[model samples]
Target: MKIATYNVNGVNGRLPVLLRWLDEAAPDIVCLQELKAPQEKFPEQAITDAGYNAIWHGQKSWNGVAILSRGLEIEEVMRGLPGDEEDTQSRYIEAKIAGLRVGCLYLPNGNPAPGPKLDYKMGWFERLKAHSAELLQLDEPVVLTGDYNVMPTELDVYKPERWVDDALFRPEVREAFHSLVAQGWTDAIRKLYPDQKIYTFWDYFRNAYGRDAGLRIDHFLLSPHLDKRLLAAGVNREVRGWEKTSDHAPVWIELTAGG
Candidate 1:
């Protein structure tokens, strides 16, 4: 089976591009981030017409996430990160589909370091760590995939020195991501292409994509069992060149059956 993740940026504005990609790639399951729409605004019919059943968590003009499955029942597990009750951003959604536990998340961007945004980012990371430990204890095949908003290593960034102080590449943020993976999750893409420089996102300004200046922020972290089933992984790089497409390209992984 194939699973993919994409940050649509704005589901409504990019609906055409999204449908086109869905038609071309035909992944069995897809995780979408950055819907940037309210709950009622989700284009359910349009997505349904594309032959997928979906469940989504949406917030107005900001973060959102969804899971879509083709020809499989999507049994929703949860909608938000479990650690905080006061936290209400639509950044996470988990579901059980085809015997796999899938988590789709849009982690906080936490821009402008030395401020509250960075603080919130760290706090969210801590919550994620706590919740992730519980998931690990279940000993199930779990795939946590999405736009994490942090580049875990210099290797994941196009220009490490230029982004050293930026929120996404700050030393602490990278450490947090590293520590999270230390909890026994395999970074799937990195596992497959150890030394390769594969990127999933590119900036709109400065001709980032044209110049191949990009960041590998979208990822798939598989539980030990799922890691063993991993067969192939790659980015739909050409999709990034599509007109009005998101800054993020679709990233996917194929797994052996019977997980």
Candidate 2:
């Protein structure tokens, strides 16, 4: 089965581009982030017509997440991340599709760091780590996939030194990401192509895409059982170049069935 994750930026604004990619890629299941729309505003019919059933958690003009499954019923697992009752951002959604448990998330983009935003980001990371630890106990074929908004290592960014002050690449954030992985989750893309300069996001400014000034922020973390089934993984980098496309491209992983 092929499963993918994409941060659509805005589902309504980029529906056409998304539909095109869906037709072209035909992933069995997809986890989407950054819907940037209210619950009533989600273009459900358009997505349904594209041959997928979906469940989404949307907020007004900001963070949102969804899961779409082709030719299968999506059993809702949860809507938001646990451990923060006061946190109301629609950044997480989980579901069971095609025998796999999938968690889709759009982690906070804590820019202009050394402030409250960075604090929130770190706190969220801690919450996610606690929640992930619980999920690990399930020992099922699971995938935690989404735009983590983190450049995990020096190789994950185009210029590591230049992004030192950036929240996404800060040492604390990177260490948090590493600590999450150390909880027995495998970074699918990096595991598949360790030495390659793979990237999934690029800034729209300064001709970043043309210069390949990108970051590998989106990720798929597989449970040990699922990792064994991983057959292939990669970024659909060309999707970033399409007209009116999102800054993030799609990242995908193919797995053998019944692992």
Candidate 3:
């Protein structure tokens, strides 16, 4: 099965691009982030017409997440991450599809660090760590896939020194990512192409995409069982060049039917 993740930025505004990609890529399962729409505003019919069933958690003009499955029912697992009752952002959503437990997340950007935003980012990371530990004990095929908003290592960024002060590349953020992967979750893309300079996101400013100045922030972390099924992984870099497209391109992994 082919599983993919994309940060659509705004589902309504980019529906055409999304549909076109869906037709072209035809992934069996897709996780989308950054819906930027209210619950009532989601274009359910349009998505349904594209040959997929979906479940989404929408928030007004900000964070949101969804999972779409082609020719299959997506059983809702949960909405929103555990460990924070006061947190109301629609940034995390979980579902079961194709015998895998999938968690889609849009982690906080936390720009202009050394402040409250950074604190919240770190706090959220801790919560995710705690919950990830619990998921690890399940002994089932699991995939944590989404726009992580983190550069796991210098290898993931165009220029390591250039993002020294950036929240996404800060030591603490990378450390948090390390802590999660240390739990035996396999980063599918990195594991597939360890030495290649692969990237999934580029800034619109400074002609970053044209210059190939990008970062690998979106990811697919497979639990041990699922990792064994990973067959191929790559970034659809051309999607980022589409007209009115999002800053992020789609990242995907192909998995064998059974482990």
Candidate 4:
């Protein structure tokens, strides 16, 4: 089955573009980020009309995430990251679909480093690491899919030096990402297309999309215990051109059944 992720930016603003892609790509499952809408305000009719079942964790005008599957069953696992009872960012949600546990996230974009935002980003990542380790210990098929808002290596960013001082490219952020990956998780896209410059997101400013100035921040990291079923991975770049569409494109992967 095909599983995909897309940061729609705003569910209400880009609903049309998102629906068009859903019809064209027809992935078995899709995780969405940056809904920027509240739970009661989500456009339920549009998604239901597309023949998908979905669940969301949302707030207003900022971060949100959801999972949509075509007739596939999902068991709710978690809503937010651990380690902070008072934190209210709608950035994480986990669910189980057909025995595969999936963690959908929209990690913080801690811009303007050397500030409180950067500190929060680091602390959030630490919590993620701890929770991820627990998931790994479950020893089941687990896929961590999300817009991580991080570039772990120079190869993942188009202009590495230009982003050196940026939160996404800072040393600490990259190191934390490395620590997560080192725990026997395979970066599906990188593993599938090593040495190839493939990007899943581009900025809306200064012609970043048209000029091909993009970053490979979206990821599907599978635990080593679930790698046997690895099938295919790809980025649906065509959808990025839709009217009022998100800067981020759709990334997907397929896995074999009972491998």
- Kindly report which residue stretches of model 2 are placed more than 4 angstroms away from their true locations once superposed: none
- Tens-place lDDT per residue, model 1, 140-174, is 79999999999988889997999988999998999
Q: Which residue pairs show collisions in model 3?
A: none
Per-residue CA lDDT of model 4 for 69-171, tens digit only, reads 9889878899998899999999999999988899998888888897999999999999989988999999698889999999988988988989999999999
- The stretch of ten residues in a row with the least summed lDDT in candidate 3 is 222-231
TM-score of each: 0.99, 0.99, 0.99, 0.98
State the lDDT of candidate 2 residue by residue for 1-259, as single tens digits.
9999999999999999999999999999999999999999999999999999999999999999999999999999999999999999998998988788899988898887999999989998999999899889995788999999999988899989999999999999999999999999999999989888999999999999999999999999998888779999998999999999999999999999883
Q: Record all residue pairs in model 2 with backbone atoms less than 3 Å apart, i.e. clashing.
A: none
RMSD versus native structure for model 2 = 0.7
State the lDDT at 134 in candidate 3: 88
Model 1 ranges with Cα > 4 A deviation: none
Indicate the worst ten consecutive residues by lDDT in candidate 4.
Answer: 236-245
Between candidates 3 and 4, the TM-score winner? 3
